[model samples]
Target: MGIQVWFIVLGVGAMTLIVWDGKRRRLKQRALSAAGISHNAHAAGSAPIPDLPFEAMLPPEADTPTATLPVNIECISGGSRIGSATHILGKVIADEPVLIKGRLEGTLIAPNHPVSVTASGHVASYIEGSCVDIDGYMVGTLKANTKATLLSRARLQGVVEAPRLECKAGAWLQIDVAQAASRQSVAMVS
Candidate 1:
């Protein structure tokens, strides 16, 4: 065929491929919708969440002085948050701090930062960070370079490695604790 004819044929083929790809994406989206799965690009980190006032993210004030909040608002002010309604099953590597109030079933690596699991959070993954604070349930290994603090409502079942480990009075723990400078791991069942 002539050069001009070859160019025309190539142009037609490109258009056909573009159209086919669009249809394929639409079909995949439809299938996910039918399965009741969210296909939002924000969940995949392709887009940011819509901007909202900071007050909208804050928890309501307690009626009495004895009631404590589930999470520390100050710690989460500029950090990443996994809301209570979210369920994520992938790896997360954050340069900033991470606050989890939902469920996570993979790895979370936040070097030189903090990681917190709130009262309603549930995590089954490996966590590595500068510090870790837990008030929820976790069933995996946690490596904190500085400290690991378990609140009154925390429940952990795995291994914890930190330079300093603090457990509250009512925390439920069934795990092995390894101090950073120690050569032995302590088994604690409570």
Candidate 2:
């Protein structure tokens, strides 16, 4: 056979394979749907609550005056505090609102909750959460899946990923806000 004939045959074979694959995928999807398998199946059931990490579940009293912030000096706050003039570096996971009145330099991860930083807060780490109320200065990636609120006195410079953003009078931001509400909606449904 000539080269052209061979090429035509190969092309036909590839098209056939693609069509077969698509049909197979459709069949699988139908079968799963029939079985009631869905992405949001867990939302309504009272199934055993998945043991989420402490960082994902914010305590109500975390914002109260009597609340004592953890002094791990390793995760959230490191060892830096107000007037320390030191750099806090590492991964920070807080299940409660954390007030930082000092310097920080690392990645902060808080999911399914909101974390607030006071006006004295100066974080140089990536911040991630469902909602983050910032009233200080930050210079890193900031991802608030639901909402990111920047207080009037807040100053931030990082990539933000959220559907809704609230920048008060003097708040600052320097990045795009990626829409993460779909993910949150899925979580809520499941």
Top lDDT prediction, candidate number = 1
lDDT of 2 by residue, 93-184 (tens): 76654546666555667776666666667765467778777777766556787888777556665455667877665454444344643322
Query: Please, what is the whole-model Cα lDDT of each candidate in the order they appear?
Result: 0.71, 0.56
Off by over 4 Å in 2: 1-86, 180-190
Any residue pairs clashing in model 2, and if so which? 73-78
| Model 1, span 35-130: residue lDDT tens | 444333122211222232212323344464433344452366678999999977667899999999998766789979999998888876477889
Q: In candidate 1, residue 186 scores what lDDT?
A: 58
174 Cα displacement, candidate 1 (Å): 0.6
The lowest-lDDT stretch of 10 consecutive residues in candidate 2 is 181-190
